[model samples]
Target: MQHYRDDFPILGREVYHRPLVYLDNAATTQKPRCVVEAMTAQYYETNANVHRGVHFLSQRATDLHEGAREAVRRFINARSTAEIVFTRGTTESLNLVASSFGEGFLKAGDEVILSTMEHHSNIVPWQLLRERKGIVLKVIPMDDRGVLDLDAYRALFTDRTRLVSCCHVSNVLGTINPVAEMARIAHDAGAYFLVDGAQSVPHFPVDVQALNCDFLVFSGHKIYGPTGIGVLYGKEALLDKMPPYQGGGEMIARVTFERTTYERLPFKFEAGTPDYVGTHGLAAALDYVSAIGMERIAAHEDDLTRHCMERLSCEIEGIRLFGEAPAKTSVVAFNVGHLHPMDLGTLLDRLGIAIRTGHHCAQPLMARCGVEGMARASFALYNTREEVDTFVDALRRVVRMF
Candidate 1:
């Protein structure tokens, strides 16, 4: 962990006279030096609007930008680069599918299934579709342990069930949903399956084809890449059938006074100027993670997470932990007795410890657990056991205060 910690220069900074302890990884990860350097290199070396210009710099920029798309395709193991579309982030990617796929295939009274553990990005888009298209939004029930009830999910699918959208890994609960099984079930019901991979992609390996999902979306920043860059991977056929998400220069084939046609596959959905530099930085981040190996990262984080839970449970009194599923990522969400999460978070910040405290954008999940909010500490591969120990010692101070 120390070897890779150098890659993230910000990790060395001080907060409130104490070492900065970054536990808000579920929100967004700090960028590695390679990722930032890549962005700088792109801006200095090949800064030009992609696909619009035919000059030397433009062609070079276009190649670099499109090459990033290929990197994304390979990262997710998609069939072709044509299946990948770049967006501002996961929110925009999910919105693209909700708007375009809904208009093309979904009808009035159709059903789109979701889970209680979903981030707001997964929930709101379908709700928008419901308001505009009269579609029914059904939620898959989850147990108190923060795991989804597959029996309830199977029951929710009827003839009207046109799509099933769910998270691969929950941002709040850290529950790793069984997307492969869910995709199989959706396919059996003749429904397309979409996965919000914002949390999962950062933690472990996720092959889009292996999951057998129709669409998958993830943000680059969550995976140590630059912000404002994300990937939306739909099956080529599905993306082709769906209409353009937005309209502008690159998405158009040839504009005529009478009729206009959209560009093919990826560009059809990507309207206006694309984030070429960010995409290049994202590719660099992907390369960095690949060099580290997801399996090794996953194993290291698991040990840290287990240590964190043990320390929090054993060292602290009257604390309640949320999302205790057997299968989960390196996220800890909990609260001490009668202490407001915001207050706890503030105290922790004063101690130079950073953790997220709130409903975690899943109000329904918080409601399900009979709480307003919980403080969360999410671990990344670069995190260390020593840091976890320091965090626990600081938490002890927080408890003593209350």
Candidate 2:
């Protein structure tokens, strides 16, 4: 295993006079020095608008910006750089597909399939589509262990099903979904498959070709990159068929007051002045992860999660852990007796231990688990067994106080 903690400078900092134990990685990760320095260098040394500038600095900035797009393409193993479209984040990426592609293909009688573990980002877009297009929305249920009932999913794929969208990993439950299998089933039924990879991309290796998903979306902030930058990878044929998500400067091939024609695949989706700094930071973050090796990071996070589960199971009294699936990520969602998740989070914060509380943007999962919310301790490459031990100890103390 690598010494992952050395890369993150924030891990060494003190909060409340104690070292910070940041376990809220599923929400957003702390950036390494490399990613921060990369963004700083761009702003301090060579900041310029991309795609339209005639000067040298402008050309350089344009190259760097598009280079980030190619970096994202390689990061996800996309078929081509044209398949990758930059957006603000996963929310915008999914919304783009829903509004542009969904509007084009879906009709009043068509059905869209989703799973019970979807985040609000994944759910809301479809809801909007459902409301506008009169499309029926169906949900695949999950078992008590938080694993998707594949049997239920298999049953839901009728001839009316035109689209199937699900998360690659459950943000609240930590269940790693079988997206490949789902994609195969959707393909068999002639439906488009989309994977919400917000959780999966940061924790595991993702290959769009291997998964055979028609569309995939993920956010940069969760992967140790800057906010306001994300990726949407769609098959070239599909993206070409869909209308442009926005209309502005760069997305246009020709402009006229009477009529206008749109540009090519990726550019059509990326309208307006683009987040050049965010894309540069995303490229730096990708480079940082690549240098460290994603396989190694996955191993470290797996070990950390196993250690946390073992210790928390043995130490905490009156605690209930959710999502006991055989395959899961670094996220551990649990409740500490009668203590509200928010209150427990406050106590943990006093100890300089940061963890996520409440619905975690997955209210449907929370309702299914029969809890108002949960305290989630999600790990990253930088987290350690020692940090897990400290978190377990803090929980025990909090329980005693109650």
Candidate 3:
């Protein structure tokens, strides 16, 4: 982890005349030098519109663009590149599914099941679909420990159930839900499963085939790549039957005043000029993590999370930690002795320790936890135990001020 820290140039900078300790990985990760350089090289050498022209620059740019698609396909172990559809980010990806799939398959009375702990990106899409398609939304409940109840999830299914969308890992809490088993249950009840992988992809390996999910969406920025680029992966058969999410230049085969034909597979969903440079950078980020190996990275972050939890529990009096599931990841949410999370977070920022303070886009989960918002510390592979110690010490100092 120490050696990998050098690859990210932003980590060396100081904030407020103090060394910066970044723990807000759930929001977005710091980019590595290779990712930045990869995007820079593509823009400098092969800056051209892709998939339209036969000129040398267009051909080169198109190849790099499609090559990134293949890289994403391999990274998630998808069956083929045909299933990968690029979008702006996870929010757009979820909206794409809600619009296209709802228009194509969901009837007026169809139901989509979601979990209590899901981020708003996953929950709001279906709510929008409900408005348009008259679909009913069902929720799978979780316990105080932030673990979803599998038996209750099983009971949420019915004949009208059309889809089950859930977070692979909670962005607010660190709960790693059992998506594979949830997918199986959804399949048994004749419902398509979609996993929101925005929080999980950067932490552990996600095999689309093994999960057997009909759709999986993640953002590149969360995985150490640039923003404005993300992936929506659907089973080939499902995507083949669904309507195009948006219609425009690249996603069209032929256009007529009366009728227009859409493109096939991924391009059908990708409506505008794709982010070719961002794709290259995302591929480089994926390559960087793959070289380090997901298993090794997961182990390192697991140790860091344990250390963070232990120190925060021991050093800080009147501290309350959230999300204590048996299977959890590298996030800790907490508050201390009637002190507002923003106060603690603001004081920590002054000390040059960065962490997130808010409902974290999971307002429903915040309500369930009996709080308005909580301070969050999310760890990544590049984060170290020394940083964790510093963060804990800073929190202790902030607590004393209150």
Worst 10 residues of 3 by lDDT: 393-402
Candidate 2 has which clashing residue pairs, if any? none
Candidate 2 runs further than 4 Å off: none
TM-score of structure candidate 1: 0.99
What TM-score would each prediction reach against the true structure? 0.99, 0.98, 0.99
Give the top-scoring candidate (lDDT).
3
The number of clashing residue pairs in each candidate reads 0, 0, 0
Model 2, position 378: C-alpha lDDT score: 97
Query: Which ranges in model 1 have alpha carbons more than 4 Å from their true place?
Result: none
| Candidate 3 C-alpha lDDT tens digits along 255-278 | 999999999888999888899999
Count: clashes, candidate 2:
0
How well does candidate 1 score on lDDT at residue 302? 83
lDDT of each: 0.92, 0.92, 0.93
Candidate 1, residues 7-42, lDDT tens digits: the string is 899999999899999999999999999899889988
